[model samples]
Target: MAETFERLPEAAETGGWLVRDEEAVAAQRGVVWELIKQVGQNLTQGVSLTSVTLPITISEPRSYLEMVADGWCYAPIYLKQAAVEADPVERMKNVITFAIAGLSNTCVVKKPFNPIVGETMEGLFADGTQIFCEQVSHHPPVTNWQVLGPGEMFHFYGSGELCASFRANSVKGHQEGIHCIDFALDGGTIIYGLPEVWVRGVMWGDRIIEYDGLMTFHDPKNKIIAEVKINPEVGGWFSWKKKLPTDYIGGDIFKYTSDPSKDRSSVSKISGSWMGCVLFDDKRYWSIKDDCPKFELIPADDPLPSDSRYREDVSYLKAGDMEPATEWKAKLEDLQRAEAKIRKNYCQEKGINYVPV
Candidate 1:
């Protein structure tokens, strides 16, 4: 079996997210089938998949903390527009575009490394927007992140918790947490949550990734809101249909009152593919095909010791050293358990409830 398979490129192309050869695909399918057999016996409704340790062959080089940073890679493009726009409705449109831009980065299907407690990552977006993230908890893993746009145009901060379950041949993940963006001007605050993620054909068939759910953006102070529904690429088990476009999203932005359900009069219609261009009322607003700026992480002069960039397992994988990477990954898990025991003892002695530091 080939330990090294082609990694996903930053942008999507005609072929697909992964450019794996036939040999690699066959090798992965064999290992994945064995894993499914082992997990099948314990499977019930909503059984947690976190306890299953995936081999290095199917894992990506980056950590989960760094993956979260990918969601804000295009902050410079849309968030900047929202910060300066005077009209509240137009500003809300920009915010929605920014939210959708992150979807493009999720095209990669490989699983990232699970972050250890105290793991941290810091970097800058293309527009010099600074971002800092930390793994605040281990059990039912949670991460807290903050992004400060250049010139203080906007502040983005949130805590995200993801729980995934093995269901049939697919893995479904539910993202729990609220994401907020506060504009420096009178744009007030915009709050929203992420859509559910599904990894289909885990054990057989062609592997396809999809994000499906309704996302609502609210700016109560400005009396405006937006609802975007992500369309999945493939139909459910009983429905047979041609594959849909990847990252297709559509919705409406409109004015609302105390109860948004009462008013559906859309001020601007949103339609487009998240991987390509987003349209507002039949006009193009954001496009990946155009010369859109890409994300580049600015090197930190004095990064913390716990930074994800310094992880042994990730570094080994990046260097194409599979054996060491897999070994270090196991060692890290054991280290995390020992550290958790120490923390629990200290907290018990102090007579205080344990809280993420």
Candidate 2:
């Protein structure tokens, strides 16, 4: 542990966050290689960056709570709508629109903080809504969350899986999950998931994240489906600085009467930006920007001993205390790594199988 922390000065020194072109590539790769050797054990396959090779300085230490919480920031937007508006069809439209508002946060490439397994987060809304999230697995990592709203509003339970790959210049992630939200009022639920994620131009300067792939939503009861696909525009050689269409996050959406495979009729086309407005049937539907709320950050003083939010290092990081943050972070990661080995052994001894689901 001491030896790994000793490399921090070098990692920070080699972290060329400001350089460009080959020079930047050289510096970024330099740090990456050192991290691979110093902090990473099995560079291939499942490994949690929260306690591994991720650089202390650049890594976003937000947590699974913050990442998934982005979707609920605008809770009232849909929750309020779901409360009233008795018409079943109208309610269904609002539900889909509500889900769309949640995904609106996915239009950009800010890396979320990784979560340690067993971490949990919960929040309450004035409207009597309760939101909770938990990091359930570390290998083939999975995060689960639920939202229960007031006055016969809705019940939502979702789980997300993050699978990633490495390349010379960047990292890519594929999000796989068929999470759903149930509104018994309409006897419907919307099931959906995200697309492939790319940390583009990682070797150029500060890494940029771009999400490209197909995002789909389906409602088994309502027999309706929605699709959102993000595709990158072409770029030429020496296009390091050239922006791609994916960067813009402009994509078309199609709402079908049912699953496209089974029923492709009654399709309504929507073309627009995921971060902004989209043209739908000659009208425009806007995306969420600041209309959401930040997750209630658990205060250090109020956290239970077991809460990840209260970990000394995380507290210091949030408070802008760099020295303690670094020290505690290193110790915490070390502790987690050791605990993982013990858990693995215990599982084997007890003949218990930890399932991803």
Top candidate (lDDT): 1
> Model 1's lDDT to the true fold?
0.75
lDDT digits (tens) for residues 227-254 of candidate 2: 6555434332112344433423222233
For all candidates in order, the CA lDDT equals: 0.75, 0.55
lDDT of 1 by residue, 253-329 (tens): 87876678885467887766665667777677777546777575674557899999899999999999999998999
TM-scores vs. true structure, each candidate: 0.86, 0.71
TM-score of predicted structure 2: 0.71
Cα lDDT, model 2, residue 353: 88
RMSD of each: 6.4, 10.0
**Residue pairs with backbone atoms closer than 3 Å in model 1 (clashes):** none
Stretches of candidate 1 off by over 4 Å are 1-28, 43-45, 232-247, 354-357
Cα misplacement distance, residue 97 of candidate 2 (Å): 3.8
